[model samples]
Target chain A: MTSPQAPPALRLRRIYEVAPRDLDRAGTVSTEVRRELLALGMSPDVVRRASVVCFEGEMNMVLYSEGGRIILLVKEDRVELLFSDRGPGIADVDLASQPGYSTAPDWARELGFGAGLGITNMEQNSDLFKIRSRVGKGTVVRATILLGVPFF
Target chain B: MKLADLAGLLGAEFVTGAEHAEREVTRAFAADLLSDVLAMVQEEGVLLITGMTTPQVVRVAEVMNMGAVLFVRGKYPTQATVEYAAGAGIPLLAASRDMYETCGLLYQAGLRPAKRKGFRLDLPSGPARPAA
Candidate 1:
């Protein structure tokens, strides 16, 4: 008997590589993703939620990580975002999720980010959220926002 | 209020997106932190009032579908920032007044705070107590 064929992979509407050379270009990746989501006919509210989460993730990567990538996955019922970074991982996930905890350098603060609300904001904006990190390895953040659902 | 009327009310200069000056603004939010602004300002057509003059500010306004942005405390966006806002079709305005005074003027002009229906805080129920 022939082996069962593997199921097709989940559809990926778009993927963006967010490797900001410097802090000045940190928001570029998020901006691109937002435009793509809007063009894909995602609801405005859904796009906003995803944009906020992605923006925070992008800024964090620029300020802390050596590099990272953002993937935008669109499905019939929901939109998903994945952010993975090759950098110093979070030592304490719980502490990092706190509202006012930050390890950003002074320069990062001067650029108007690093207020320490990135992770918490991401969690609050998305309908579903998950984070994974290893001290010496890297970090990954996943956020999902369902479509056609009233956020309120 | 319309963007034009808001500009006049705050004596703001139209930095960009004059084509959208007639856009209606139903609510206002004042904050320097982008995350707070994103989390709390929930409605479309809301106006963002802030002192930060960076491209990220425009990015936030675009994502949130805000009608416009008013820079307070005489702050002005750089050329690149203005260009970005214009490209994004988000009008940018600047007033010399500080954030507090600017928000006060807008409030007096009937612009209320944006309702955050997504996140609401309620006090815990308790037994009735005597008033002090």
Candidate 2:
């Protein structure tokens, strides 16, 4: 039962904890995030991009780092996701952020991940993205997706 | 093409989501790397061609707004993965052909690439992607 309970959003916040090596339970968070976004009246385009960001962040935590938590913060103008993980932090954040530069082991590659595109994907889908990591400590990623008005 | 028609053309069978057999899907993206799928898929209702049958495949189809997934190389998903895809409402299909052949057949049938490749200025912009 370590798949992490999704507490109902008190207002516009949902938090999910991801466990390392929990490949069996991966991607559930992204699905939950998509459902919630659609329910809240967000456009499908916005929902799709946000879900991609969430899944990439979730999978990175599960496959690489020790473990981590993802927080979805929905505001009036934009939806932001906060991802923070436990150690085995990156030695160089800049190099790691580059697409196709990966340290993922062969096993992760087999499951169709660790293409070194996780960070880049998140960045591509987000209007704003930031990453900070300390070698001995951990990594924190913040991604913001701006919501546009729909002319219905 | 209709989901059912596409399945029949590939000589594939549905493992789940047969209810969506009438859904229209005109584009497809083929890859085993989930990250690549995430970065590249930009349109809604495209078909997914992959060699994997894991739950993550279904999750990607959901997240990317794909209409259905066709598994190549005779692969199949477990019950849990099928259940997840059913819940997600993304059709799942299994084909006996290898990845290369699947792509070839789909391409020959006039299915476009999943997304614009390089966004280069040299090539003519094909008819814009239809509304979702």
Candidate 3:
């Protein structure tokens, strides 16, 4: 998840795993991520934004992927959330990112997921965002919310 | 408005976190779709109105920092969901009224709607103003 826009370095925290089709455990990882961010005394704005991003990514992984893991990266000047999933990867990232566009299954749709807003929401809340996917291989999303930025 | 007063006005039964009655919320975002909630709720300390009563409802409120959740149409969350909300400090309430009347009462009682992109929320004055 290296990027020129990211700060010089970051301390990696725990990696949260999202299980496939586990409606019972869907929100677990996002809750844990929120707890850790709160424990670290991160700003409320950053924590809320990060948690929303994490929860959306977690839900996407659970709803569509075989499974996935989210890694928390805490840099002195920013926080990075990385989601990598083993799923039937998207054939079109651009098409997938469009609002209200989703390939989510019926059960997931009934549960109010697959709004097709997942990627867009993550991108909006995040100061820096990137998604990389190989059609048959998998997908990865990295969202960074910078801290102490003057213009933020 | 205080959560307790809002609950009382709506005749809602507290499913959890009655102790948080004193907390105040001046805005609300009403939606049964969890993703819509996630996408649109940008304010903390607001009420979330929904017809869904699954644990996911509470989870969404928690992540979004909603002050409390109001379940309409007589829906109620499960035991585990209530317990989870208690632990998370996000209160839950269930009202017998359907979504339409429930939102009407809330709006009439002064809980403004949460802001949305490209949508103006300002209620114009005069004859056009919605009756309380």
Candidate 4:
């Protein structure tokens, strides 16, 4: 039997092929997506939060995973984000989820965002969060947010 | 005082939000952490002073809906950062003064961070919670 398919709203709206080596580039990609989402009339508040969460998630994927793609899906009622990679998966999700838990290389911390708030902030900002991983295989994170009525 | 006036006073150059240069500023807060800035900043008219040069700085200002951001100690932002601020339409300023001195200068000039209003719980004369 085939597994159930994702809803149409969960389908990818944009797929960004970004180098998973530079956190700054990842942030730029995240910003570009958010600008388009805002232009599409998404709530400003939600867009801001989602942008940050998505940025941190993308950066984490780059720093941790071998490399991957960022898929952004927007719907009338909600937005869904998916990050997939083929790097070694998290051994202890609990520890990683902790506010200050970070395996980021020291160089990243010097860049000012590796304070270990990546997962914590993502979870805090997103309404629905899921992390799936298999040792030596990879990890995928899914985040969803309920869209608010746009003022415009 | 107007943002333009402050910019001139600090010998700082502008990046964007020039239209708001004449808008009055009433307060200032300097910080690198977005969470702290979000919790402490008063509102729309406050100027943010910080030394941390990062794109998230502009993103935080966007989220907080701040008036302007001044990078103290003559810290110039990278080209990418300037572009980000310009894209967001947030006024970015560069000042040679340190954070403390910048805050002091602004404070002496009559700009102050407004106190945040707290929620009030009315007493005996107050209306009770409505039943669901």
Clash number for model 1?
A: 0
Candidate 3, residues B1-132, lDDT tens digits: the string is: 998899899999888889998999999988877878877887788899998887778888998899999999888888889889999989998999998898899899998988757522222333565788
What is the Cα-based lDDT of residue B125 in candidate 3?
Answer: 34
What are the candidates' individual DockQ scores? Answer: 0.40, 0.40, 0.39, 0.12
Q: What is the DockQ score of candidate 1, to 2 decimals?
A: 0.40
Specify the poorest-scoring 10-residue window by lDDT in model 3 chain A: A4-13
Q: Write the per-residue lDDT of candidate 2 for residues B1-132, one digit (tens) a residue.
A: 888888888899999988888998899899999888887778888899999777888888988888899999999999999988888788899999999998898889888887755522222335687899
Candidate whose lDDT is highest? 2
Q: Candidate 2 chain B: minimum summed lDDT over ten consecutive residues — where?
A: B116-125
CAPRI accuracy category, model 1: acceptable
Candidate lDDT values, in order = 0.83, 0.86, 0.84, 0.72
Candidate 1 chain B, which ten residues in sequence have the lowest lDDT sum? B118-127
TM for every model, in the order presented, reads 0.87, 0.89, 0.89, 0.74
Q: How does model 3 score on DockQ?
A: 0.39
RMSD of 4: 8.6
Tens-place lDDT per residue, model 1, A75-110, is 767888999988778989988887767787786666
- The TM-score obtained for chain B by all candidates, in the order given, is 0.88, 0.85, 0.87, 0.80
- Docking class for model 3 is acceptable
RMSD of each: 4.2, 8.6, 6.2, 8.6
TM-score for chain A as predicted in candidate 4: 0.85
Instruction: Name the runs in model 1 displaced over 4 angstroms.
Output: A1-11, A148-150, B118-132
